[model samples]
Target: MTDVVGIVIVSHSPLVAEGAADMVRQMVGDRVPLAWCGGVGEGVLGTRLSDIRAAIDRAWSERGVVVMVDLGGAETNSEMAIEALPPERRRKVVVANAPVVEGAVLAATEAASGAALATVLATAEEAGARCRSVPSKTSAGRRQ
Candidate 1:
């Protein structure tokens, strides 16, 4: 568990980030390092690059870290955070395109299992498919 990748959740709402972190803890317990940052000063529903950077620093790990963002602007800020890291450390981080809640939960679980950084990130990315409508069956009952 000590070597597993950590997770950082960046949301437009502080409550959402904290709630997602809470749910992730429920599944992964204390095995994974989870950090979250949301809302600008005074509870505004906005993401601040500095805040995201601070959260990533808090969740830093030797194994790597995966960041999940809930909005387009958040994603842009997340990219800036990654770019801010030294070149050597940048490769170890990824900004997942997965939904915040599902991605955080899946990432935490994979990390707790001591999965490598790539695997943990892949699990989180795959979680996005879960939100898709169920596969439709053709007349032959084969999934579309």
Candidate 2:
């Protein structure tokens, strides 16, 4: 596996980001390049632009990179970090719209399978909607 698309996890809590990375690492092994930034820094609870930017740089890949964030501030800060990049490189960074932990797992799987940026992004974005707890959904809203 080439591990084309990289992953970055951002959260207001350092432990959350670290734990999510650990989960993705356990699921995907070393097939995914993982980077993350969390906390306000210095034992505080908040997200910082510097931390997000550093994570982006660390996880960057020529193929592309996807970032999964915990909340609004994380998302906003991640976007700002991407925007700070050169215009050409900005598009390479995508902020995913999915649950951080689950999305990271699916995205890592897709990337490890040598999927392209779009496919990886699609998998992450769609992960939250994937079958969970039940086998399948029926038109009548019953579990199949």
Candidate 3:
């Protein structure tokens, strides 16, 4: 069997992250290991660094982890979690560009295993471009 691609979405609010994950499931049927961390929803919330770390650990057991954050706080926390992991484990984590929904969906729907992380990232970035939130000057920043 092919190795699965793990996806992690961290947001300031778990509701939003869950919503994104739900959208992916709606589209892709949930075969992938998708993990959501951040603010609380039901009983699964990880606002603290430790919570985020645990969530990542849970998601990164089999294959690699693809992380998507909603804002600076979530992004920073995810980054911290990855940095704190052992070098070998840390290699399995990937921080996505933006629009976790699009990125994760594209990653989950492709030939990602046995390939370089860069290839997966490229696929995600392309997916994000396809779902670009209205052409704006802000997008220009990406060129720089």
Candidate 4:
């Protein structure tokens, strides 16, 4: 609906997807179209292609849409949903390889700024690289 790129969040848990969407809404407000989907149904913890497709539809924008997902299953389902879209629509949607919550926030923030779909995706994926670059402490109390 908005000129800015749209954002969609997917997760295995319904609460996680909704919570991440809530954070984006709180921080980004109504600057961009945003939607989220998680779980199969009735408290079940799983991702569904139909749900993802619906979320993408809800968040569709002429500018394009960036999808952030948690877990391998979620990513797989997201990809499947994207593939199901009409060729033109499929071109405008992408599954970002970034942590769901953080990526959704960053992607949404960038999209709200009227950035292009590719730029928004880059912003979201950057979160994953930044997270990986952070040194982790080993059990031996040494940075790994």
Please give the lDDT score for candidate 4.
Answer: 0.86
Query: Can you give the TM-score per candidate against the true fold?
Result: 0.88, 0.85, 0.75, 0.90
Among the numbered candidates, top lDDT falls to 4
lDDT of 3 by residue, 1-144 (tens): 226667777766677777887876787765666777667446554455776788787666456777876555566677888999999988888787756666767766652344445666677778767667743113222110
Better of 2 and 3 by TM-score: 2
| Angstrom error at residue 115, model 1 | 0.5
lDDT of 4 by residue, 1-144 (tens): 569999999888889999999999998898889999988788888888898999999999989999998776787778889999999999999998887888899999999888999999999988988877642211232110
Tens digits of lDDT, candidate 2, 1-144: 224789999887889899999998888988777899898767777688988888878887888899998776787778889999988879888988777888888999998888888899999988757635432222332110
Give the candidate order by descending lDDT: 4, 1, 2, 3
Q: State the lDDT of candidate 1 residue by residue for 1-144, as single tens digits.
A: 448798999987889999999999887798888899988868678788899888988888889999998876678888998999888778988998688898899999999989999999999988877765632111332110
Please report, in order, the local distance difference test score of every candidate based on alpha carbons. 0.84, 0.81, 0.67, 0.86
List the candidate 3 regions with Cα displacement exceeding 4 Å. 40-46, 111-116, 130-144
Ranking by TM-score: 4, 1, 2, 3
Query: What's the C-alpha lDDT at position 75 in model 3?
Result: 65
Worst 10 residues of 2 by lDDT: 135-144
RMSD of each: 8.0, 7.6, 5.4, 6.0
Over 4 Å off, model 4? 133-144
